[model samples]
Target chain A: MLQKKVLPRLDESLLTHLPPFSRLERRQIRTILDQATSRRYDQGVAIFDEGAQADRFYMLLDGYVRVVRITPTGEQVTSLHIPAGQLLGIAKAIGRDSYPATALTATESIVLSWPTRLWETFVREYDGFATETYKTLGHRVGEMNTRIVELATQQVEQRVANALLRLINQTGRKVEGGIEIDFPITRQDLSELTATTLHTVSRLLSGWEKRGLVESKRKRIKVTNPHALVVLSQG
Target chain B: MLQKKVLPRLDESLLTHLPPFSRLERRQIRTILDQATSRRYDQGVAIFDEGAQADRFYMLLDGYVRVVRITPTGEQVTSLHIPAGQLLGIAKAIGRDSYPATALTATESIVLSWPTRLWETFVREYDGFATETYKTLGHRVGEMNTRIVELATQQVEQRVANALLRLINQTGRKVEGGIEIDFPITRQDLSELTATTLHTVSRLLSGWEKRGLVESKRKRIKVTNPHALVVLSQG
Candidate 1:
């Protein structure tokens, strides 16, 4: 049987700076720390499965977690990547009994988790916590709505360009030539993100490389000319 | 100058019955009603334009509003529709200063609006209200995530079928023949919703009609064989 007591202690300051928590008082923050425990996983491990009981939620401490949904035929599509210092497994906050998607480790990862039962307690007790959580939800919704419109209206090239821009914006790291996506994202992941095929993504990347708009090798991508990519995305 | 006092008095029960409000106390409910005002718009009129200051937010009372985003070249794509009893123009809740998308009336509409300045007051004073609002935000994000995955994974026919099923679930009315989408949704609207073209939508609907799976005329669509549609969407 698993035991909370045996878990290694973690710095409480990690929770204090995260949004929803940044709104909580020192005492409330301590209460959350008391209820939380830390865990680490190797890359490619499943943190939780789709349709599993969402009895708990997690906040990342280090590394990446890819959120994915398995199609009826058992094919996995990458939905989004969760980086360190953000929350995942939030299905319970909206009163769902099961997770809508599976969270898989994309890199060696550390996460701090809290039992779902305490979700209501925090919402009831902390205004900043509730407001910030809701704000995060709203922003995500808004981003998806934008994607829906883009999918309906933009061409494949434009969609690919926009998806790349979004990925870079979310997790890009400053580099000499330009910004790198800051994670290992395969071509198939970009295809899934933009609703295109791997072949199309490859062809587009080849064209962009020839034009010096971007540079890619294996799973890494860097925007060599972000302004041009932005222009292309607008079309 | 637009005067809030010139608006017609709305039944406070409209706010009382809505989510977030449904969770608030009677006194709190009265306070919301005091700060609110009713407004009306004719079909095809813009309620709020994209990039406009989001000084207030709205909840529908009657008719429909279509959320849209205009592309760089002036193409308008329908993002989603808001039926009576849901909130719109909620940019401020997420900390944005301007509306992200334009909201236009799909039919003659009545709405109750509250100033954005009071958003914090409500969240701070009423925990249930904040929770419900966040819950709504979370649910919307979840739905959009589902749509993104479907767009990435499903074929056009499957997407169209799923979109119809979703619309029917949201606002269907039982008819003698089948379940009919309640609003006057044009084929163009269906095209936008499903990320297909008008020609493709027309062809699909025509094929469905010949097979008796659905009957669509003008702007109305009735699912004559929901089971078959479901099966088709599963593909």
Candidate 2:
């Protein structure tokens, strides 16, 4: 229904840079864009909830969405963040009956969505799209395998160092001191990320700040010594 | 090519139960079976090494394969094990240039392989195959997300309990004592799976045995009280 009420067609040019679409030829991109409906959300809005019927999936045109899951203990953990030009809610597109996690907009965001019914049609028509999409999923599984290994073998200090390094790699902004994480993340978020307590994350950041290895203020973090962090993460 | 070596044709009926193949029609299954090559490996043999050039992916016909990744510190960790009827080395078939982990035969195994080049051909021709394959990958990603959350938030005991339950669900055998994990898996494997230490896993298993929660000897484990594990994993 959103498709029928679209104000104006999304620029076909934006589709050229997204996965599945990026793999599409010009005409194939046009065909998909014709069926897409664009929507915007305010920062901190829930895009979809866990256990919701998975009828559609979204492609981010701008901004960020964080995937959060509530454990059996009722603690919420943000598992991953989706950046611009990437797809989310892919479980539905691949035949899952419901979403496994809640997706919340981390910032004011724009997303282009398509009904799940069209997923097979696109795959049947475009080999590149399906291949690229599945490849992305495979890469994610590989990354999580690495994280599991890290959590299993590494010390808390090392885990924190690794988490910071990964964050910087994914969304770092170069600054005078070093590379600052480009997202608004708190110590609580860092704690959830590194499998540590908030106190532990705070202490580690403080110690790193004292050594000029990192700079932190409020919700922001900057890795001042990337090499040192790498050395520490290796432990 | 293995298919041309005439080692005898793979059983077409087995293909009907495996993914992608399972989604295919009888005629389509025969078409794919014609291109598949059956090979056998001895227990502990390396099926594929991490970083090897992508060429082919396999479907297990018998036995198991353990997916192992070596850390930057030279520690090898077994990330997961794939039992018969599941697919492996799928990254290559989905556009990745190389295997992300080393896959070793956990037991003497029979596998049917298809060259990566034919992946696109199958997807373009078979909507069922593509949908099923991508669905499998999506399920894997979802599983990993759950593991990541557990590692990030759950305690070591809880994680161990969760891992054991998951393994039993995947490959449990009913026994007089309880539900036994139907595979050869050592304490070291348990340690790696739960992100704990060998000593810790040993100690925890011993403590659980004293409490009549589980029974273990060498590489085998039996859950005498599955309900306890469920409660523990929830913590």
Candidate 3:
């Protein structure tokens, strides 16, 4: 969970952490960051909602954020979780003047909000801004490509397995026995994320529990044999 | 289809064709274009392959390109067609270091290629470079989002109708009888694009042809009732 004071310091260090920004470019980044505002959110608080106009693009100094799409039944399909040092908003930052997805604080989060116009200005004046943004763009497109393949090619079981593996790889917190998903995600959330029925997930988890592959509590699961789990995922 | 000479003078003017590029930004873009090398691809040439390492990025000066992926059974899925004025080799330009999809020229095409490192430099040094790249990134991500929604929410009939709409909207070439898809495409290609089977596509086309909604020959299909098709798509 992200809860820290990170937005107050308008420094080149944060700017250089992303691609293509050198120390000199960091000075210009400082100029831009100085103009930014700081914001914090408690766990489960929404940073922004779907369709919000792109006013500010936030850089996470500390904490994690979740991007989700709310279904008709009020179910949230967790599309992705953004940890520290990654960008928080881009759809609105680049186009359509809108936030395409909803953002919620997964932990205590500290964020720096720059006037969306500042991003535009920096993009105009700084080469680092544009290239870094492009790199970010490549990543977003790659992700969507993977998701399309998942939806079109993989079945429910495979999708769930891959999703869990992805979570473990990207945002898992190591424990004594195994790795726990850093976010406090529920089975229902997992079901929506995989586009499968909750009943199916419940059954699958029960089976995995008995097989000593995973341990599930009310809203958490600890992966045991990650490699074997991946082999099962191959099925 | 795009067929134009890659003249450096066109860089400033190309900005006029797209929105959001200020006059000064146009000049900045020209610098990036100045580094580009002109290349040509004959019809049926493979510009890049799916899963291949992406090393360079291309901008179409002239000709049509088909972006495709191959399945395990050797079936090909037509992902998208690139027209003139659009950038190609997106995965490389965006820094994936690999081609996400293959680019196959439908006709002889003129493309401008930049050294992968130079492109990275431009992304880092040129202001317009990063913003333009981010915009391109936004465009691809938005396109993929539409595909995800279509795959999840739309029925097969509606999907076909929407695909026709998309084809017409992107690259429809009007002929004597009606609107023909700009490239040489088959029912099988259409099936792959819409994620349905060829037999189902054949049956659907037959039904539409009977209703005068669309007409098909050996490999071409022309839309007759564009509005009616829209209604069908909405259904």
Leading candidate by lDDT: 1
User: Lowest-lDDT window of 10 residues in candidate 3 chain B?
Assistant: B15-24
For candidate 1, write residues B80-178 as lDDT tens digits: 777788888878666677898899887788877888988778777875775676566556667777777787778999999999998888888899999
Sorting all predicted structures by lDDT, with the top scorer first, yields 1, 2, 3
For all predicted structures, in order, the TM-scores are 0.88, 0.90, 0.80
List candidate 2 segments past 4 Å from native.
Answer: A1-9, A23-31, A125-127, B1-7, B23-31
- Return whichever of 1 and 3 wins on DockQ: 1
State residue A65's C-alpha deviation in candidate 2, in Å: 2.1
DockQ of candidate 2 relative to the true structure: 0.56
Task: Estimate, for each residue in A1-235, the C-alpha lDDT of model 3 and write its tens digit.
Answer: 4323353455567667665355245467677667777777888888878778887788787888878766444656666667777777766545557887788887888787776777667666876566666676667666666666676666677778888898888789899789998878777778767767789998888988898888989878899878878877766
Expressed as tens digits, the lDDT of each residue in A1-235 for candidate 2 is 2334255666679878766776667887877888887888888888789989888887888887778888866777777767787788877544687888899887788888888888768766875676677676666566678777887678999989988998888778899979998878889878777778899999999999999899999989999999999988877
Best candidate according to DockQ: 2
- Model 3, residue B159: C-alpha shift (Å): 2.6
RMSD of 1: 3.1
lDDT of 3 at A193: 71
Cα lDDT of model 1 by residue, A62-163, tens digit: 888888888877667677767788788888666576888899997788887888888878777876776676566556667777777877778999999998
The order by descending TM-score is 2, 1, 3
How well does candidate 3 score on lDDT at residue B99?
91
